[model samples]
Target chain A: MKTWTIKLIVGGCFILALVVTVTSFFCNDDFWKVNAAQALTLILTICIAFWATQLKNDVRKKKEHAEQILKKIQAIVNNDGFYYVSAESDAIETQKRMTMTFRSLNNSIDLLKKYGQELGFKVNAEYIEKEFKDYRDFVSEHITDVDYLSRSESTLRKHSENIDNKCDIIIWGLY
Target chain B: MIVINISKDFTDTPGARYKSEGEYSGELFRETILIPKYVEAIASKSQLKVELDGGYGYATSFLEESFGGLAREYDIQEVLRTLVFESNDEPGLINEITEYIKMARRERK
Candidate 1:
């Protein structure tokens, strides 16, 4: 469980203990009061001194992992290689360039995904790298067929625009 | 049984492994074409025969993701029962794919 969740649960338990203690005192139940107080003290001490401390340490580790992931993600954001799409006159060549471009982005995004998986975070932007395969396939099929090349190029261009949008979303979401 | 040619119906970019578009990469091939055809074959009670010919050499990762992931998604028995790969002159391509499927099944266990 999250450290904060554990803390909240422990806090609730302590409040319940206090309410029980007050009720027992008003009822003049000295034996029950003493037992409840001792039990609460022991339980609180164990939870606070051991479990809470361990949970805090776990939280600290996760924080460090997040910081590390953010650092790597930021470093990846500065990589401007995927920012420019080739403007080559050849539709086939241009599409080939885009495939390679997404491959590069995929590698970057995949690395971050690996780290995110390890740290138990969601990295849902991998489609920026992987989902372009369908368009690439369409482009590749029409590479030699100039008659269909226009349609392929147009579709690829549209998909490229969508990919660029996802790229921005991925960059912003690294945190 | 329905046999689909990888190099013909798909792209003939041979010797490709990982992330080439079309039938060249295993993952893309599986996601785009393989699974769709497989599902169709299963629904129709037909065995899907996949021709691995005309494409580039296979990569272990691609094979793993395609067949292995398939095993992970569906049952290994179902995949084995529903699918067949043409030797495509590649002596051990089917074996390699089967190994991956087996590995994935073991992982599930």
Candidate 2:
């Protein structure tokens, strides 16, 4: 049973006990009986109040626990790869889905590396440098064309500036 | 009708393994192609027929489903007889297949 249900049952029993004691005292004309009844009722009242306080504390603790779990999941998502955060009491379907997604991501990353290798082109600094050189040559050739240069001076200037920036980046990397 | 005969020796590329891991593990590289409307229509029309070379059929089914195009799996002997044999060693065949796929996709669209 849930924690709340257990608390309710225990509280009900304490109240019942208090009621019976008080009723028995009224029925009898004994002084001890009345005093005992009063003492029992006071004890039961205190027990009920204590139970209420515990229930409140339990609710607060649960809320804090859930928030902490959420923060952990968020941290994982941001730092690590995408994955499902399974709760202790998560349904079977939820666990299955999380597993599937994780597997899929793992496979994709693996395949990407394989494809890069298969294509003789290395996706690294050497490839980037070759591409930059080709781009620079293309821009220089276009800029040197008298008709093209005359017609679009601003555009040519922009292209040359971009090539210069790329050269600068390459030089910075080398150093 | 352009028929592509992929050899059994062709294994799933690392990329292919990742994308369709649980679902498919075939040699057909659908990721490299850019097919539009017609490809989708062809896939939708193609019925999945399983045979001894059922792996090809499964891969075709996956592509058909993904691209929304038609795909028909044939026996190795039947494929060899009907389709023009393109040497796997030829780099041009890749381009040809890409072009044919694009053309078929366009026509279907």
Candidate 3:
């Protein structure tokens, strides 16, 4: 339940307890009436306490899940930077690795989008999806282009810029 | 019809390990040789034929990344209509390639 609703319930219960005490003091002071009022107050307090505890546990779980997803997003960024730098070197082996990296990068970005959507980051998910599609189209086009190995460096950089732009929002908004 | 022999023109050994079929290992073959050659043939409106028997063997990855990738970029039926198979040495190779193209289309859908 909302914080306001919780406060309202607890406050209302305290007021009822105070009213019962004042009425008993002013009236015939029936012992049973006082006892009934006390019992009702105690039950409401206990129920409120239980609800608050469950809410705390849920918040803690969400925090942990958010932390885990942030760590994964960081790893993806690190790999993107590594691949971008690796692609720029004038080496055949490195060049070959760049294509493989692009494919792997695609899968990572896709997963990030999925996790974001599940976390209710609808806007962020859309951004990731649009950028991912662009990356896929670029790869499909060049996966057959001449000198693709050497030419892919700039493309990798393009992906780096595109993906990094949204990482901030994911980190900031989800938490 | 215009034909390019995979073993003769592109590479004698064509395939990716089944274990890492997603290698994109043979990407070079597809991008640099196979696609350009195939596109050149298709642009001329000439029926393009791929001679598949000369290669050491075919990998599902290589075939899919090439023909399957092509089907994604071009019209599947048009691509298939313009293409033929010269797999006399291995009659099944043509069917496998066709299957890859069909499957790739389904995957995209």
Candidate 4:
């Protein structure tokens, strides 16, 4: 089973052991020794549970961070044309990687946008970028890309003409 | 799979050279071009071949790393055909690559 499950099991066992020790002390006349053992076991159990919970939280935070990084990378690779850096940036290596990935994504978007314009494809970069940014902002609060993208797309479509040029400029600026 | 051979000479153009020699040489051209292109091609149900001219120097290192990163992310093996000589600047290189692509397409058929 999972490590967390194992920890929980072990922690439960310690609590059980403490309960048994206390009960045995109350039943038999060995008041001092059994009570001491029960007290120690109870403290150890609490400590173990606290540590296990901390470890689980740490693991969860790490997984969330990794997923966030992957999402940013995937967004760049998927030709979304925007890179959103967390307000709290990390180390030099992370910054370098993020910058490089953003630059690359930016270039690709520029190339595609240029190609679309040349081909007379009705893709407004500014509109798309704004919608994407707004969606990203929404997701920052809501944490859902699909919902954000859908809502932004609908909103952009509703106000397309006025924001067409604006959206194109925003996408170009992202690079 | 559509494999596009990217030679060091392809990145020797003034724009590419400037970008490479700039403060972000670690960023590399392949990371900028080949990796995204490969990902795009794959997502669109196409194969990409990145033909390398040689397996040495800064250009090679960048290409290798970029290819490895893409491969790892995609979880699919990629082909990196190393040419004995660097020839991206040569006019015939494009033609040679076009032929290779054509042959691969035919094999797929």
Across A1-175, the per-residue lDDT of candidate 2 in tens digits comes to 6989999999999999899889978886773644778999989999999999999887566444433433332332233112112233233233233223323322332332343343322243233334333432332232212343244444434433443443334334321
Docking class of 2: incorrect
lDDT of 2 by residue, B1-109 (tens): 3333333322221112223333222222343331222244245643221111212111222323322222222222322223232332322222333343344444452
As for model 2, its CA RMSD to the true structure in angstroms is 22.1
Clashing pairs in 1: B14-B55, B14-B56, B15-B56, B15-B57, B16-B56
The TM-score leader among the candidates is 3
- Evaluate every candidate with DockQ and list the scores: 0.04, 0.03, 0.04, 0.05
In model 2, which regions exceed 4 Å deviation?
A1-34, A83-175, B1-109
Show where candidate 1 strays beyond 4 Å.
A1-175, B14-24
Task: Please rank every candidate by DockQ, starting with the best.
Answer: 4, 3, 1, 2
List ranges where model 3 is wrong by over 4 Å: A1-48, A78-111, A140-147, B1-109
Give the winner by TM-score: 1 or 4.
1
- lDDT on C-alpha atoms for all candidate structures: 0.59, 0.35, 0.62, 0.42
Per-residue lDDT of A1-175 in model 1, one digit per residue for the tens? 6999999998999999999878877877464545778899988998889987898788667646545544444344344322333343454444444334433433455555565565444444445434444544454343333345543445655656665565455445544
lDDT of 1 by residue, B1-109 (tens): 8777877876654212345443345567777778888888889999989786664433344556677877888878888888888753454458767877778877885
**Candidate 3 lDDT by residue in tens digits, A1-175:** 6989999999999999999878877886464554767999989999999999998888667656655654554566457443244334543344344344434444455555566666677677567657655654454343323355345667655655666667666667755
TM-score of 4: 0.25
Ranking by lDDT: 3, 1, 4, 2
**Model 2 residue B42 distance off true place after TM-score fit, in angstroms:** 36
